[model samples]
Target: MSKNLVIIGSGGDARETLEAVEAANQAGTADYKVLGFIVEARYGTPGALVSGLPILGDFDWFAGRAGEVVAVGAVGSPVLRYRLVERAARYNIEFGNVIHPGAVISSSVRLGWGVIVEAGCVLTSQVRLGDHTHVNLACSISHDTVLDDFATLSPGVHLAGRVRLGEGCFMGIGSVVIEGKQVGKWSVIGAGSVVIRDIPDRVTAVGVPTKIISSQPPANWITQSGEK
Candidate 1:
């Protein structure tokens, strides 16, 4: 029997996750039947269709319907993603994951609930992805890398062996993190940057050899654990 699944968000990331789940369902690797999306009240109208799927309702729609549907957070904003997960958890809603059929994942990899590994992603041995982590298109995560909760890796990002990405960290497109480097909580690595050393919390770094341009928190940033 296929479980009813809902994706929270209606943007590009949400559509990507929907595709991955659709592929998984077609490949018989997963038993999820995607029901639709739950867009925020501000972004969409309930009962409207998006990508052929209905927009069920806003976040509050799940409040009293826990355990009846499995949900996956599809937003790329780490803070917003955690907020949805934590909120849904209060109602005992079960979480689901999405992995594209084309992804290469090692047997030793451990993925937490609601993790999304998109097509062409390569996750090497002993990789640990925390809850709601998003590994975008063609990203490569080498051996023993750990991505804490709500970490978001953009398209074509590469992480060398034993790297640790802190909670809610965002690695932009085409960025590279050398071996054993640690990226701090809520930090943002700009596109095409190369991280050679550790980065501290709540900063934005950029350039070929990444430099911390600002120590300020990202706009609308919240902790990965949903702490204010």
Candidate 2:
């Protein structure tokens, strides 16, 4: 039997997630009957179509139906994704993972709920991805890498062996993290940057070898409007 599924978001990431789900179903790896998207009332209107799927409703749509449907978070921002997951939790909704059929994931990799591994991603041995982690296209995670809850990896990012990414860390597109390096919680790595050393929490780092540019409180990232 196919399980009912809903994606939480109406943006590009949500559409890409829908494509991944469809690809998984086509490959016979998943049996999900994706109903539609669930977004905030302010962001989406009920009955609207997104990538040919209806905007089912807001988070309130999960009310009284939590036992019948499972959801996955698809936003690009780790903090925003975490916020949506928490909102869904208020209605007792359970989360599910979406792995694109094109990705290469090792059997030893450990994935948590609401995780999304997009097409062309390569997760090597013993990679542990915590709850609600979003790994975008063509990224490579090397052996023994650990990504804590709400981590986001942009397209073409590469992590060497033994890398550790703390909660809600965002690795920009084409970024590279060397072996044994750690990026702390809520930190943002700029695009095309090369990280060689450990990065502290709640800071924005950029350029070659990654220099810390600025730092902000958790509230700055985890805002109601989902803006930094």
Candidate 3:
């Protein structure tokens, strides 16, 4: 039986997920015949197609059929992806993960549901990746790293041992987090930055030692003076 799958969002990450799904289909390791992608009616691109899969409908239109399909949140923005996932959760949408053909994941590593691990990525022993997290192309996550839900690592990001990343965080391409560092929720680590210490929640940090720049309030953070 060809299990049906529908992807959410229409973007670079979605395209990559399509490729991974194709790979899975070809190998028969995963059973999925793509029904199409679902997006907002205004953004669904009515006649537009991805690899011959039509844009199904708006999320509301698609909700009734979610029970018969598997889906993935393929947006690049960690914050945006989390929001999307939360929306889908109301419909009890089941999220499927895309693991590229060449990534190496250790048996001791614990991967949560809805995660995507692109090619050339390495997950060492005891690593824990939270739900909806993305480990992009060529990234390396060393032993004992814990990446929270909806966190993302752009291409070539490297995370050393025992590093902890909070929910909805984004690590820019080539960013490097040294061992024993922890990044707080909703933080952004710019490309090529080196993290050596703890970063506060909702802050954007850049530089070798990763000093916090002025951080805006997170979507859920309500306060005038950075206070909880």
Candidate closest to the true structure, highest lDDT: 2
Best by TM-score: 2
lDDT of each residue in 67-138, candidate 1, tens digit only: 689999999888778787777777788888899999999999999998999999999999999999999999
Runs of candidate 3 exceeding 4 Å displacement: 218-228
TM-score list, all predictions: 0.94, 0.96, 0.92
Compare candidates 1 and 3 on lDDT and give the better one: 1
lDDT of 3 by residue, 6-27 (tens): 7888778888888887886677
Task: Give every collision pair in model 2.
Answer: none
Give all candidates' CA lDDT scores: 0.91, 0.94, 0.84
Question: Which regions of candidate 2 fall more than 4 Å away from where they truly are?
Answer: 218-228
Measured with C-alpha atoms, the lDDT of residue 189 in candidate 3 is 95
> What TM-score, to 2 decimals, does candidate 1 have?
0.94
**Where is the poorest 10-residue window by lDDT in model 1?**
219-228
